[model samples]
Every structure is written in structure tokens, then in C-alpha cells.
Target: MNNASSSTPLGAARGIDPDLIAGIIIVLGAGALLTRTSDMPGMTALLPVTMLSALIVLGLLMIGRCLLRRRRRGDPEATAPAPLKVFDNARRFFGIVVAIAAYVAGVALLGFYTTTAVMIPVVAWCFGYRSLKGVLLADLIFTGGIAIIFVVLMGQELPTEFFLR
Candidate 1:
């Protein structure tokens, strides 16, 4: 049924709101995270659980806003949902999957820091980032930040496998 012809039991028309759809999706994802993390031991689960809970709250707010907007607009009936452009090309999506798989393999052989540094530029290039200087700078900054987080802040004992081993 179209927007104008359909109406809820209370006579309010059912209109599809993008905000409400996105909010529902986010809430589902956050709920999944919450479910997975709730069973984990120690403080490892604490951060993710807290973050997911906040995400759920934000999603609900989005949904509430969408409902409010629809109510204020005074919809005539049910509206069709907007199309979500997720994958324009199947090959491109498959290629990205391959790239991620290669990234995982590369990490085992080349180490986390090296693989990440290389992967960032390749992924950026694949996504149409043509500026060499900008890509390099971004790659450097991103890799450096990750290195600092893993090596300095977390104190993870990760060594360069390809160079050292």
C-alpha cells in the first residue's frame, strides 16, 4: 500500500522514515554487541558493553525523533521506504572482501604494524584517493596512532616478524 491510502489503527498514516530505519538497524547491532559482550570475563567486556548501551540509547533517540517528525508532518498514510544503496557493484564488494582476507593473512606474516601501514594506503587507493602526498600523510598518521596505542599505551609485545624474524 502507498502513503496516502494506508493508515494505522488510530488513523495516523504509516510513513517510512529513514531516521527510524537507521535507528532500528543501529539498535539491533548494539543489542547483538551487548549480547556477545555480556558473557565475557573480566574488564575486557566492560568497555564494549558500555559503548553498545550508549549506542542503543542514541538509536532510540533517532527513532523517537523520526516518529515526532512524522507526527508533526501529519502524514496522509503509509509511505514506502527509501532505497538503501549498499553495494553498487558485486565485483567491487567481492574485491573488498578479498582485500580484507589478504589483510588478515598479511598480519600473520608481516606483523600488525607493517600490515596495517601497507593496508591503509592500498584501501585508500582502492576507494579513489589519488593524492599521493595526502594518502601518505594520512597513512603515516593513522599507522603512527595505532602503533602508539598498541605498543606504547597498551604495551603489547608485538615485534616486526618479516624484518626481525
Candidate 2:
């Protein structure tokens, strides 16, 4: 196969844009998040609900951008796909999904801060991050952000481990 064909990412060969597919998936997940949180009191769920709402908006924007790009198909740059680094991006995507499932389930047992702090680095690795510093930085930034938002701002207590309690 020529370089062009080899460079094409997954789903493009069948006329599907992987980005568009991801956007649809993200939107659906966001909708599920909203549905799950709907019954919670607004005061208790304010931050999570707000974050999910933003995710939905971003997902819609992604979908719209993909549609617009497809409509304006004349540009060569737009037509070309990114280089195929992975044999199938699906494996990486699946890994992320599994990791997320575990993280969510872990939160109840491990508590929010600890689960989040640990999961951030694991999820970053699932996304192909290799640098130690990069992963550590991501963990720090995200953990700090969550602490500030949920702990300091919202004044919500994260569940503590049995020993820590």
C-alpha cells in the first residue's frame, strides 16, 4: 500500500471519520452522565452537572466541526488523515474505556481524591503518554484542580480510606 493509504487512521477507509465517531460517543456518554445526575439536588451536584453540561457542548461542537469539514471537502489538507501510528486505535480506545470503568467503581472504595489521583496517571498512559514528567504533571494538575473545586470550593468531603478515617 502507498503512504497515503498506510497513513490513513482507522474508520477512514470506510468513509467514517474516527473523530466524528468519538464525538458521537462522547455526546452519548455526557447524556448518560446527565441522566444519572438528574435526580441529585442541584446544590450537591452543581460541579459534576456543570462539567457534564460542558462536555456535552464540546461534544456537539466536535460533531459540528466534523460535519462542516466534510461539507467543505475541497481542501487537500482537510482530506488527508493523520499518520497511522497504531495498527488499530480501537485497542487504545478500549483501554481507556476499561480504565474509566475501573476508576468510577474504585471511587467508592478508594475515595474520590485517591482514586482520582491514581487514575489520572493511569489514564494518561492509556492515552499514549510516555514521559514520566508529563504523566506526573497531569496527575498533579488534575488532582490539584479537583481538590480546589470539590474540597475547597464546594466543601464536600471525599470518602476516606478505612485506615485514614
Per-candidate TM equals 0.56, 0.68
Per-residue accuracy of model 2 over 42-61 as CA lDDT, tens digit each: 77788779889999899999
Candidate 1: lDDT over CA atoms?
0.76
Q: Which prediction has the highest lDDT against the true structure?
A: 1
Where does candidate 1 stray beyond 4 Å?
1-78, 81-86
Model 2 / residue 96 / CA error / Å = 1.5
Error of 1 at 69 (Å): 12
Which candidate wins on TM-score? 2
Worst 10 residues of 2 by lDDT: 78-87
Q: What's the lDDT for all of these models?
A: 0.76, 0.75
Candidate 2: C-alpha lDDT? 0.75
